[model samples]
Target: MLETRIKTRSDLKGLLMDAQDLFRDATTATGSKADELRNRGLNLLDAAIEKAQDAQSAAVSTSKEFAQSAGEYVRENPWKAVAIVTSAALLASLLARRRD
Candidate 1:
């Protein structure tokens, strides 16, 4: 099986769902083959969970860095940031109105 990069929330949800389904089947299985399959599933689920935790930690760190950098930039250029935000909000509102 190919490992996928869980970069988005949707990807994480999908991985969790897959792991859950496998676990559900594993619990109901019997005999040596079933035991083998269950062990494989457990290993896969464990790896996926570890990877998810690592990704979450990395994401949190990256987001904090980005926010700190953005805060510094905005503090140095307050007016520019305000103007940009105002323009973006205005454009979003206009787009919403057009959709309505």
Candidate 2:
């Protein structure tokens, strides 16, 4: 019976060591996976920022061209442009008053 008890204790110690090793391996694996995910997230964010910058630059260029064309059109039709502006102003004022 004493020999059996000693053997059982030895077996328990070995199992404990194995459990500890498994826990350590799991922790290391989780940390490595987290680092990989973090790197991927940062890369995606950088790509999104670059795409946004490109889109903003395109929008600015388009706005400039549109403004230039509109200016020429307004100069060619001064009375019509004035009438459109007045109508827009009136509409804006009416909308503002309604909001209030």
Question: Which candidate ranks first by lDDT, i.e. highest?
Answer: 1
| Regions of model 2 farther than 4 Å from truth | 1-31, 94-100
Residue-wise lDDT of candidate 2 within 22-46, one digit each (tens)? 5555556667775665555555455
Output the lDDT of residue 61, model 1.
83
lDDT of 1 by residue, 1-100 (tens): 0133435445667666777777778778878867876777777677677778877787788789999999999999999999999999999999999998
lDDT of 1 at 73: 94
Q: TM-score of every model?
A: 0.66, 0.56
> Poorest 10 consecutive residues of model 2 by lDDT?
15-24
The predictions' CA RMSDs to the true structure, in order, are: 4.9, 24.1
lDDT of 1: 0.77
List the lowest-lDDT window of 10 residues for candidate 1: 1-10
